[model samples]
Target: MCGVDQLRVGLVGGGPWARNVHGPGLAAHPATEITAVWTRRPEVAGELAAEFGGRACDRLDDLLDDVDVVAFAVPPQVQGPLAVRAAAAGRHLICEKPLAGSVEDARAVVTAVQRAGVHSSMVLTLRHSPAVREWLAGLPSAPAGPDTVASARWLSGALLGGPYSASSWRIEHGALLDLSPHVIDLLEAAVGPVASVGWAHHDEPDLWRYGLVHEGGARSTVTMSMRLPIDPTETEFAVFGPGTPHRLAGRTADASTCYAALLDELVAAVAGTGPTPALGVERGLRLQELIEQVRATAG
Candidate 1:
């Protein structure tokens, strides 16, 4: 955007999501210049800092003072307070999705950004994908009958728990907030607003699973457990677009080079040119609300 000049970034999560998505994505942006990174673990922070040749700050506040934007990649539970502080400090926020663990906290984060008169964003980078872009551009009028969605299911398996910690506060009662939101967002994009829904959750000490029913006869079933034997990774949204069963592929796939194109769109957003997506913090919060509704009934 704006001819892609250097824009400073302060990353606030150095773990897998950060390392895999945020760090690489920002580094590759034509207009972005990462200045610092923050993580609770000094070893991880310092290691990335050295690799990137940037400073490693222990506290998020300190990093705030050092960069133009903050990419929040921390766990879902730790995001609210950090977002509150970052927004108050007047830095643009690039938050990871599932915006917050719950709708209430997501609202609070949005409120903070508004109160501070700052620009903030939640990174659902998938929305910027090429397939998603073209597909969304020509999305047919909403279908008028029963719809079935096959989506990503990851939980209680090596996918979510083996390497990742169960210590995170992603779910208290259900996996709807953490796992289902992605699917719901995709479904909403393909279909219309979900007017009402029903759900069932299979909760374990470290796992949560569910089946969802949406208005307009759309239904989806998913499982998010920390005790899986395999890592379930597949995200695809299919709907009869223009009567041809249009599909833009799924989230578990990156063959479309979505992240790279997404960064370009972000640049476009900053430039005030082309549509990079107008989704703001508020939209994410709204989605979180829908997620909570489905999650609350997990039993």
Candidate 2:
């Protein structure tokens, strides 16, 4: 457990997301502090630690010793083993989407966290946005039926020419791995659990389109691409039902703001003052399973 007033955080990864959102958000949040930093690149870790008020640790073990929890912004493959080690060390976890590169790895992390009895949360940033939360809250609480349907599209040029463009994992995996988790998660949260991927397709230039059947008989279709030429990225989510359609258009709050909200939940969980995070590691594992199903269907 963390200190009653503040949670000491060990941040893994010094990439753009880590530098811009995780590190800054933790430093700015009243209930948390970036107590230690570790990354594959020592200099990058040192830079982040210098800017975020944490010590640059040469090893992950050293960082774990200094912090009450671990927040990961690393790639999924790298994050998996490190998260397992951190959970084994009895620290709480704040993990990135998909939990890990593979479903098996994600499940391992889940098992480790459960064995340690540590709290865990996934970075489903949109769910933490006030606007997105309001939109979700307005939707009908009852399980969706066949008449309920949703459509979402997230088209971006993230892998074309941006800070994320250089990401090897994003390039290799495309938007299905990078963006589908958020879309699928939101759809399920708004409607019902995804029972299966009805159909899926992946075209050149990273376009992905898929249909899903929700367990409650509702359905959702998703279109995504990170290599599009579109400027300002187009994103929208709309659900249609018997009464009226609800929509959450464009981006929600900035990553920093959403991350702050996530921090609030994590802090509360760590202090035993709140329920376990709704978007936790087990949730990540489930998303991974759904994503894998989509991939298989696409092929």
lDDT of 2: 0.92
**Candidate 1 overall Cα lDDT vs. reference?**
0.65
Evaluate all candidate structures by whole-model CA lDDT and list the values in order: 0.65, 0.92
Worst 10 residues of 2 by lDDT: 1-10
Index of the highest-TM-score prediction: 2
Shift of residue 219 alpha carbon in model 1, Å: 5.7
The best candidate in terms of lDDT: 2
lDDT of each residue in 154-178, candidate 2, tens digit only: 9999999989999888989999999
TM-score of model 2 (CA atoms)? 0.98
**What lDDT score is found at residue 141 in candidate 1?**
51
lDDT of 1 at 139: 62
| Weakest lDDT window of 10 consecutive positions for candidate 1 | 150-159
TM-score of each: 0.80, 0.98
Cα displacement (Å) at residue 185, model 1: 0.5
